[model samples]
Target: MSNELDTLLTALYVDLEDRVLPSLGWSRTHRRGRRPALGDAELLCLAVAQQLLGVASERHWIRYARAHLTGMFPQLPGQSGYGKRLRAAGPLIAAVITELARDVDSWHDVLRLVDSTPLPCAASRETVRRSDLAGHAGYGYCASHSRYFWGFRLYLICTA
Candidate 1:
């Protein structure tokens, strides 16, 4: 890894471990079950690095991490294990994101933009019937497309 990436990861890890995690009252030691080989802070850092590096696939990310990030994360989990852990860490990830976003100078800006897009969960009648989103997702019209879609709406709000 380049020096810039190393610096960014180090700073991110410190901020997460010392500030973000503590503020959220989350401590891995307090939780039950076996202590994970990869700590939450490290996992979160890994995720940030993956996104920054534009590695979309978790399996490929794991492979890359194992090859290049062994120094930072000595005991990285396998692809499946990593996926499970990442899923379980959703709340933690959200919290970290909120904290980091709040720290940004633009967070308090008055100018904001909001938009929504259709997230089609199912298409065919049989697929729609079998889909777990049967009740949660419903038919909605898309003004832009001039068509109806069956799924949930994804809204995004951000500062201008």
Candidate 2:
């Protein structure tokens, strides 16, 4: 593997192992909160490995595990279990991602691209009728877009 790829993998694995796994103390030893069947570390590692391999969607993720992750992980957890594990760790995962900052030395020091995107919060018809954005969802109105979009506006940060 290239040095960059190796560094990223090592950083990701170590971050998952040390920072992400410990916060998921949702379950009790006496099973008060109900333990996730899969270990937190295994689930995170498997999901990240899938993401690194560019596998999206839960079904294809299972196929990826059957092909690549199975040999690496003796547990080789099932798709359903993986889904549950991911759900349990969702907030922590997002927090970890948000906390990660770019390493300036690792950067190219050339042109930088900073952008934004729409992260819609389910603006379906019924959703519109029930949401605070109901009045805002229509033609020619988006506070964030500053223009007409057929859907509700969203805000997110992007960087490259």
Candidate 3:
């Protein structure tokens, strides 16, 4: 809606279409079956925009996009369709992220920052006992909260 956001989206879409998608060998004609109304680049742009706008729920994002971004994205998919496309585009998304990160100046920096957060898988003792994550997940203490949790640690490392 804002001028800055519109500019950002435009620039992002151009970069994706001209550089990222082609480099990944993802041309519009490569896929089989009926062509989607939304192209891969456009879908990826929408995904990035959703993240930038902090719209977490796919249903809510679809509603918001339909209301606010319809001018930019004329043909929008339904919530379920968007979810399926997003799930299927996971590998493409990862590849794009990698490619984009490589272009960032700090990506090659030696200095890095590391963080770990608790990803709670279960709360109840019974649930923990029956959960399939028994072998992979275990009890851990979160120093920040001064509490114990039954989950796996999610670690994130980023360039400084």
> What's the residue-level lDDT of 90 in candidate 1?
98
In candidate 3, clashing pairs total: 0
Model 3 lDDT per residue over 99-131, tens place: 998998987889878999999999999999999
Ranking by lDDT: 1, 3, 2
**Residue pairs in clash, model 2:** none
Let me know the TM-score candidate 1 reaches against the reference structure: 0.70
The superposed Cα distance between candidate 1 and the true structure at residue 12, in angstroms, equals: 0.2
Candidate 3 overall Cα lDDT vs. reference? 0.92
Looking at model 1, report the run of 10 residues with the lowest lDDT sum.
151-160
Per-residue lDDT over 60-101 for candidate 2, one digit per residue giving the tens place of the 0 to 100 score: 888766775454466766777777778877886676554453
Clashes of 1: 0
Candidate 2 lDDT (Cα, whole model)?
0.60
lDDT of 3 at 85: 95
